[model samples]
Target: MLVDSHCHLDFPDFENERDEVVARAGEAGVGLLVTIATRVRKFPVVCAIAERYDNVWCTVGTHPHNAAEESDVTAEELVNLSEHPKVVGIGEAGLDYFYDRAPRDLQARSFRTHIEAARRTGLPLVIHARDADDDVAAILREEAGRGAFPFILHCFSSGPALARTGVELGGYISFSGILTFKKSDALREIAKGIPHDRLLVETDAPYLAPVPFRGKRNEPAYVAHTAAVLAETIGLSPEETAAITSENFFRLFKKVQRPSMRSA
Candidate 1:
């Protein structure tokens, strides 16, 4: 049983035939799926999916690309929205210097605000860092200074230094389909060193789908491919990779209430 720790089933890419998309996820052995958030103002859409699926959960956050538009967001609003049972975490939020669609300052502040909200709420912070490794690590270290909160660096494609920093900070590391790419030898090596207890897997679907499906629009069902490559990368059986990562997901996202969470 695999758990895709991060995905976006709420996106329109799966809109017309979401039932099939979800059914495919189950058929692929994806036992649990977490629908991530990109816009807090539009959270009702994300929440509706989590509320509908017994095996799905969600988060409350604004992606860095929308930082300027949602600059007025407060931790209180995130906290209030996160009180729902299905809302298990906070933010797919973090620095994204690669795009810079949002001002760096706004992104940093929004990232910290999500961190603070996670600290207050006792929920894991689902982070998204892209070409902003130093800034992201710095902010996480600084926030940890104030008070340590649970966090997972999702869809990680950065260097080993960032991975080490996250592990040293007692945070979790999640790899996406990017790891299955032909040029991801270095990433595969880095993933090999991640402590199994702190390692996670995600699809980040409708985005970086793994090889064999890389060019197509990704869905939760493809997470199994990522898991297979990760297993081969780490020299474990695919079944073991599923069990280990699923356990890591539950350990990191403790607030999530899934039947597997209890078993793991």
Candidate 2:
């Protein structure tokens, strides 16, 4: 079984057939799907999807793009909302200089809020970093000093140095379908060196739908393809790859309740 460590099922892209998307993932050997919160104000949409599916879970945090809108959100709100059993992690938060969609200052402030929430709740922080490597790395290094906490650079596309710093700080690195791209040899090189205990996999769907389905809409089911690529990069079998990454996932996102075997 595999877990889609990040997704945005709440987005309208799935509204017409959310049920089928969830079913297709189950049929694809996916046992758990974590629909992440891009906007805290839209959490009801995320929670509703999670509540509807036995194997799906959710998180609460503002994404870098919406960080400006949620600039006033507090760590208390994040921590309190995350008290729900279905809520397992504290973000989709981090820097994204690629678009500068949100004011950099707002993004930094919101990212810190999520970090504080993770520290307060003892849950893993789900980070999304892109093109803001140095700032993201420096900020993580700085905030990490405030307290001991766990976090993951989800759908990681950063370089090996950031990966090294991430794993060095007791964080996990999750690879997405991007690793399967023929042009992403650099990403594969980093994937090849990730320590077993710190590696995880995701789809980040309905976005970056991996190769073989690059032009298509993605869902949790596609995590299998990403895992297969990782297995090859690390010279392991697919099943072994799944087991290893799943174990690392459980270790990092400690708040996720392991569903019973029946649900799995």
Candidate 3:
């Protein structure tokens, strides 16, 4: 079985066909899904989806692009919300200089707050970094000095320096469909070197659809394509790749109970 480690099932993209989308994922061998939170204020909507699906779980933190609006969100607030049974992670939060949707400093502040909650709650931090690798690395390192926390660089598309730093810090690196892009040879090269135990795969659904499905709306079902490509990149069979990444997913998101998979 496979897991789509990150997605946005609550987004309007899946509004009219949410059930169909999830059913397709199950048909495609995706047994679990974690729909990420982009805004703390809308967390009820995110949590509702998780509540409705046994195999679906959720996080409770704002994305970097929406940081400005949630600048005052406290670590305690995140920790409090994380107490919910369905909330399994702390964030999809981090720096996003590429968009500059929120002021850089504000984004950093929000990122650190989520880090603090992750440290306090012992939940994995789902980071969303772009065009701010240096700062992301520096902040993670600095925070580790105080106390280490589990985290994953979600949908990673940064430089080798950042990838190396994240792995060295004992964090997982999750790749999205972007890895299957024709021009992502360099990204593939980086993927080849990551330790199997520290590697993961995701669809980042409703965005970054894989090669064969490029230009189409993405869903958890498509994570299989990303996994197949990553398997070839790392010299593992598709099934082995799926198992390894699913293992990594459960390892990092410890709050999630690993589901039983029957033998064929």
Candidate 4:
């Protein structure tokens, strides 16, 4: 079974049909989903969605776009909020120079705070890096120097340097629908070089829907399409791709109880 390791079920895009969206994922063989949080203030909403669906889980942190708004959020707060059984990861937070929605310094500060929470809580940090790979890598390296913490480079679309740095620092690289785009040859080459155990697939849904469904609103169900492309990219069958990514998911998000074999 596939695991959509990143998505936003709490977004208004799925407000009216969240149930149907999740049902479609299960029907499509996506046995698990993690509805990532983009704001700590709205965390209860995100957590509620996870609580409503047995197969769904969540993370807690402010997105880089909202870093200024949640600038005062402390690592202690993130650790406390993450005590919920449904919260399995931390931060969709990192540098987003592409958007520049918040001050870069604020984004960096928030990213480090989330890292601290990850270190304290042992929940994997769900990092969202875009157009700021160098700074992101610097922060990651500096933070790793402080102490090792598990993390996933969520929705990764960065250059090879950051990809190599992430894996070297013991972080998993999660590819999204972008991996299936026709022009992502360089990204595919990067994927091919990644070690099998450190690879993962996600949809980052309500955003980049994989080929054929491109431009359409994405959902957990479409993760299978991305998985199919990843299988081809790495010379594995669709079933093998699903198995390996799912295995990687559980290994990193250790708090999540693996579904029974029968469930798959």
Candidate 5:
């Protein structure tokens, strides 16, 4: 069975087809999906999607791009919101220097807040680090010193240095559809070095769809394509890749109940 560790079903791309999108994921052997939240105030929309799907789960926290807007959302608020049964993680937060949609300082501050919540709840922090590798690694290293917390570098497309830092801290590395792009050989080489138990897969859907589905509207069902390429990059069969990543997903996101894989 497979698990899409990060996606945004609440996004408008899946509006009228949410049911079909999820069904397709199930038919593609994806047993579980964790739709991420990008804004704290709009969490109800994200939460409602999770509540509507038995096999779907969610997180609570703001993305770095919107850090400035949600600058006031406290760590305590994230911890409290994460108490919901369907909320399995703490964030899709971290730095995004490429876009610089929010000020770097605000992004760093917001990242720390989410980290604190992760530490308190024992739920994994679903991180998204882009071109700001140095700051992201520094913050992670600094915060981890206060007390270790579980986290996953979601949609990993950064430098090897950051990947190494995350692994050294015992955090997981989740690959998205970007892994299947033809020009991602360097990224594939990084994936090869990660410990098998620390590897994960996601779609980050309504965005970067994998090859064969590239240029198309992404959905959880396409995570399998990403997994296939990732398996090839890491020298494992697709089925084996699925099992390992699914196990890793459950291991890190302990708040989520592992779904039965009778059909998987």
Candidate 6:
């Protein structure tokens, strides 16, 4: 079984075909999906999707782009909201200097707040780091100095330095459809150096689809393509990639009950 560690299922892009998309994921051997929340205010919409599907789970917190608007969202509120059985992780939040839609300072502050929530809740934080690798690394180190928290650098497209820093801090790195791009040789090299136990796969669906479907809408089903590329990059078979990443996912997001391990 495979797990698409991060995807925006609540987005309108999937509204009409959400059910079909999920069914396809199952057909494609993806046993689990985590629909990420980009806005705390619209969490109900995200949580509802997870609630609707036994194989789906969700995370709560604001995206860096919406950090300013949801700046009022506190760590305590995130902790409280995460008490829901279906909400298994926290934040698709981190610095997004590439977009800079929100103030960098506000993004950093929000990132730290989400870290605190992850610390408090013991749920893995799904981090989004774009062109702000330095700040992201610094904040992660500083926060780790205070107290360690679990997290994954979701849809990683940063430098080797940041990847090393993330791995050193005991954080997992999830590759998205971007990994399958022809020009991602450098990314692939970095993946080669990462410890197998710390590696994961995601589709970031409704966005960056893998090679064969690069120009189309992505879904959890396409995570297998990303996993395939990751396997090729790391010299593992596809089945090995699936088992390793699924193990890594359950290790980090301990709140999630593995489908096979759940009570009938």
Candidate achieving the largest TM-score: 6
State residue 37's C-alpha deviation in candidate 3, in Å.
0.3
**For every model shown, what is its TM-score relative to the native structure?**
0.97, 0.97, 0.98, 0.98, 0.98, 0.99
Q: Show pairs that collide, candidate 3.
A: none
**Which portions of model 5 miss their true places by more than 4 Å?**
261-264
Error of 2 at 34 (Å): 0.4
Candidate 6 Cα errors over 4 Å, as ranges: none
Q: Rank the candidate models, highest lDDT first.
A: 4, 3, 6, 5, 1, 2
Candidate 4 lDDT at 105 equals 94
Candidate 2 vs 3: which has more lDDT: 3
List, residue by residue over 1-264, the lDDT tens digit for candidate 3.
Answer: 999999999999999999999999999999999999999999999999999998899999999999999998999999999999999999989999998999999999999999999999999999999999999999999999999999999999999999999999989999999999999999999999999999998889899999899999999999999999999999999999998999999989999977753222
lDDT (C-alpha) at residue 259 in model 3: 72
- The candidate with the higher TM-score, 4 or 5, is 4
Model 4, 189: alpha-carbon shift in Å?
A: 0.5
Itemize residue pairs with steric clashes in candidate 5.
Answer: none
Model 6 residue 63 CA deviation in Å:
0.3
Q: Model 6, range 92-125, lDDT digits (tens) per residue?
A: 9999988899998899999999999999989999
Task: Show model 4 residue runs off by greater than 4 Å.
Answer: 261-264
- Candidate 5 residue-wise lDDT, 148-240, digit = tens: 999999999998999999999989999999999999999999999999999999999999999998999999999999999999999999999
Q: Estimate the overall C-alpha local distance difference test score of candidate 5.
A: 0.94
TM-score-better candidate, 1 vs 6 = 6
Score each candidate by Cα lDDT: 0.91, 0.90, 0.95, 0.96, 0.94, 0.95
* Count of backbone clashes, every candidate in sequence: 0, 0, 0, 0, 0, 0
The collision pairs in model 4 are none
The RMSD of every model to the true structure, in order and in angstroms, is: 1.6, 1.3, 1.8, 1.3, 1.7, 0.7
